[model samples]
Target chain A: MTPQTGRSAGPGVPRGDLPHRAGATGWFDTRHRHLGDWAFVVNRLSGLGLVAYLYLHLVILSQLARGPEAWGGFLAIATSPPVLLFDVLLLAGLLAHAFNGIRVTLLGLGLVASRQKALWVALMGMAVLIALAGASRILGVTS
Target chain B: MATLLQTPRPGADADPAAPARTLRVRRHRRGDSAEGWDRYTAPVGPRTTVLDALTWVRAHLDASLNLRHSCLHASCGTCGMRVNGRDVLACVTRLEDLPPGEVSVEPLRNQPLVSDLVVDIESLYESLDGVRLPLVRTSEGAPGSTPAEGVGHLTRFEDCVECGLCVSACPIVASDPEYAGPAVLGAAWRLVAEPRDRDPEPAYALVDGEQGAWRCHLAFECNEVCPTDALPAEEIARLRGILLRHRVVRWLQRHARPEEVQP
Candidate 1:
């Protein structure tokens, strides 16, 4: 389909004379082209996951409602290698989602117009933090 | 009757200006049939509008031409048609101003097409109808009871012609089928933001469900294409802020209740 043109064209040239190009060029281009949509979708899904984690953590903490035996079992399940790995993954997704959301929020608020590089930097920072904290906990360096 | 004196004729033939170029308009013959372009000659003039050319074609060239237009001016808001693949007011688009070539006219996208160059706008109208575009009045006295001294900001929002260009151009509408879309939200924002709108609580609940303003990711495509300067992005943003604040306030109120408080 031809791109719409207005009286802006010079005489004798048709609007569709120009080559047809898709709105997006490649995978990277689409990611940036539909950045708002992608960001919203990723943020919402990750937020839901984080909310689930919050509820799960609250429930595990509510083991205080039970005796130490129950709390011991819950902690064991949580600290198991697989569960710990999943937790790390969840934390990574959460941080990425949140930092990206904040970046978008800043852009939307006009607090920052040239936010692309800044968004990447913020996301990388979150990844580093998540990796460091998760590795330290898993390697028994700290709780 | 007295006989009048006869004058001699010198001209053997008279020729007027050459006919202007033919404009090929797409005709949607059937509900399921593919659309085809049908050429119709039009008089070229600097000030001639696309709507005028279409009207001339319909009147003299093809009476079977199907299109919806009303109020040759933009105020009536009915003459919105896609000119050259973009949504524009046909009445306001002068032919001479367009590129000197074949201009493709089509029905508005993301909506049902009733016929050539006419899309069903009832869906948008229904969405607007669904919004409770008013604030409840207090029992003591009516809101806006004082003389309607117009505030420029609020009153300008009321100038929405409901042309649906914003809706057509909106990326949200393209992605989410259930979105109330920009036109409806634009109208809703007018009432929601009105200074005299009493009991704004109702406006908060009006858009809670699927594809409401919350679905809008602040693309601002609606704001960019609005024929009138009704910035829908600003309005939707304000609505989001109001709704979030209201929820937070309600949560605080509930938590602060005496029964919920522990000594």
Candidate 2:
């Protein structure tokens, strides 16, 4: 073992010049090279996207104050093919965020901490299944 | 400061034409000094481990290389280090399991680096010690007396082995030094979960601070890197549950007794 004494950098001391910060972007960038880590990043990103969409949704709803013609015109543009595709993407994000949330909650409750990788795979699979079902219904493929 | 050392030896019992594989080790001269990675190539056998490669490098090439290992097996956690950016027991991490080409070895992160591949684990032990955990009996029994009936079915709580790998893998401890990492909180959880512990209240109070269970983000990195299967992330989650229940109960009690509330 290396001699413990005379080590200038002790525990709790910051090594400023080190190549990487302790838990900065390194946590998500370098260290997070596994499936579980990717799940966490995706969860956070999807959550933020959902929040942004919610604000935009509220803004769109407030267009009703401009009268029926304005509101109807906005709805007509919103339901166009491009907007519909964006909505589908939003739905995918919502499903991913919701399913991953359940997985994280179960893990926090210590229900399936050991089988987290399997749980993640199962939840992501379920998310894709639900998203596909919702997409077919929204795009008039199932009707 | 990258030095490549290659050693060639013909095998007596096995095929002699097998090319040797290189082990790349990241080394730091001092705790505060700049770091450099060195490469050492040694003949790989069926049972060669990362620890064996380090041993070979030290024996043949560099005497100044510093590392710690004992038992040459996974029993002793002294050889814990980051192999290929992941925390693992060097004694048990086989070279064959690593990706083809080079295997990188470095000291455990989030701790005081004493020298090459040697981290100061005293702080981890001190954090566990600060909890002042004791097994409190729920029944009217002496300290050394046998347990009463019906209490034997409680699940056994595995104690932290002080390997420091979990702490090294903990991002909370890496960023914030004040936060007591998984190993410490996991030990606290084991004591708090003891069925016979009359007053787990003290254990709860110990971890009630901002740097305690509340700070954990439930990343599960500690659980992923734990060599002993101690499951520190699960323990931290359990501790969070206990602390949450405690806060809710305390809030309810305070609201229930309106007369005791001072104006």
Candidate 3:
């Protein structure tokens, strides 16, 4: 859609604001942002991913209602390498959301207010390490 | 996507004879439904600021170009604008200090666009009004710190210049306009921290709700962009602490025996 009077937006930028700050886009725009802002973006994106995964998980579980044959067929698809890779991605999203969520909780309760930057780095570091371990386990790279 | 320039240190602009720079400035006027960019070549020196280049373009290239400034220095905070997606004072931000390339200049976000590079900052002042932010600040009495020989106390203007930079940079303000932004929240914390005989309850009442300190998702973008180093997010957290303690005290009062409740 044409969002400006004189200028047409570039392809894939269907929702540019009227010569203003990118409103909802700021949630994903990390180019000009700081560590805390990136953390918020990561947390928001991961939260949405986890919610989607939850619904997908429930729908997959509903296959059990179709009897043993259908359940067995679905299990064949579920344990495939592609599905396992998707599980690794889901694990990473969960770790990012959960760890950053803890950091946000501390901030909201007025704890460690001054050391926020340091706190974000520490928490995100833990999230990365845990995500790496989870990914290796899901991909069967570890014995 | 607009070509954004990388931020550079101030000391890089030591040479005087710099090349002509490209300024891709945002353009709009009254009754316009949307806005667009206009590219202009500004012949500039090494020390030439974004304000200087824009003023030059206005004088020679495009007279219709509208912008606002007064102090020329950063003290007035009137020349605030976004250079390459970053909020800054146009007068103080030199073009050369930004990485060499085409620079995109836009009006500050989260404020009513007046036209071109000017934004109406009435919301900022209106938010400040809720807390009645004082101009001068009481000094901290650090050990061995002394005032001037003839002076009894040390006082100065608070760090916040009411520039609205923090508001413009805030992601919460972008989503929810009613959210009291960092500038005002920081001002509120000042009153609560040092009541100086005034009741801090009113300030507490203004920012204790969902639209206040609690709404801040801890982006801390305000702290990053504040030219004055106000540490607004930190102040908001501290304000939340005060509000929490106040609520706990009132809850205790209500639960106590009628005669035992402290006045």
Best candidate, lDDT-wise? 3
Q: Give the true-contact fraction for every prediction, in order.
A: 0.04, 0.21, 0.41
Tens-digit lDDT track of model 1 for A1-143? 22222323355643232111121221112222334434545566678788888998887798878999998988888878898778778777777777867766754443443344446466758766877787777757796
The DockQ-based CAPRI class assigned to model 1 is incorrect
Question: Mind giving the per-residue lDDT tens digits that candidate 2 earns over B127-245?
Answer: 77776555434553457777755333222224345788888777667777778888888877876766353566666776777777777766678888887767887777777777777
**Could you report the DockQ of all the candidates, in the order they appear?**
0.04, 0.23, 0.31
> Who wins the DockQ comparison?
3
Q: What TM-score between 0 and 1 does chain B of candidate 3 receive?
A: 0.84
Q: Give the lDDT of residue B67 in candidate 3.
A: 95
RMSD of each: 14.8, 6.3, 6.9
Query: If the candidates were sorted by their lDDT against the true structure, best first, what order would they fall in?
Result: 3, 2, 1
Task: Report the CA-based lDDT of candidate 1 relative to the real structure.
Answer: 0.62
List model 3 lDDT by residue over B23-121, tens digit each. 999886644556778777776686899998888777666777889988888888888899998989899899888998889999999888878888888
lDDT of 3 by residue, A1-143 (tens): 22344344345544423435557876677778898898888888889889889999999899899999989999899889999998888888898899999988888778898898899899889988999998888788894
Off by over 4 Å in 3: A1-21, B1-18, B135-157
Off by over 4 Å in 1: A1-103, A107-143, B1-22, B132-150, B195-199, B259-263
What TM-score did chain B of candidate 1 earn?
A: 0.79
Give the Cα error of residue A109 in candidate 1, in Å: 6.8
Candidate 2: clashing pairs of residues: none
Candidate 2 segments exceeding 4 Å error: A1-22, A27-38, A58-73, A109-122, B8-19, B31-33, B133-159, B195-199, B251-263
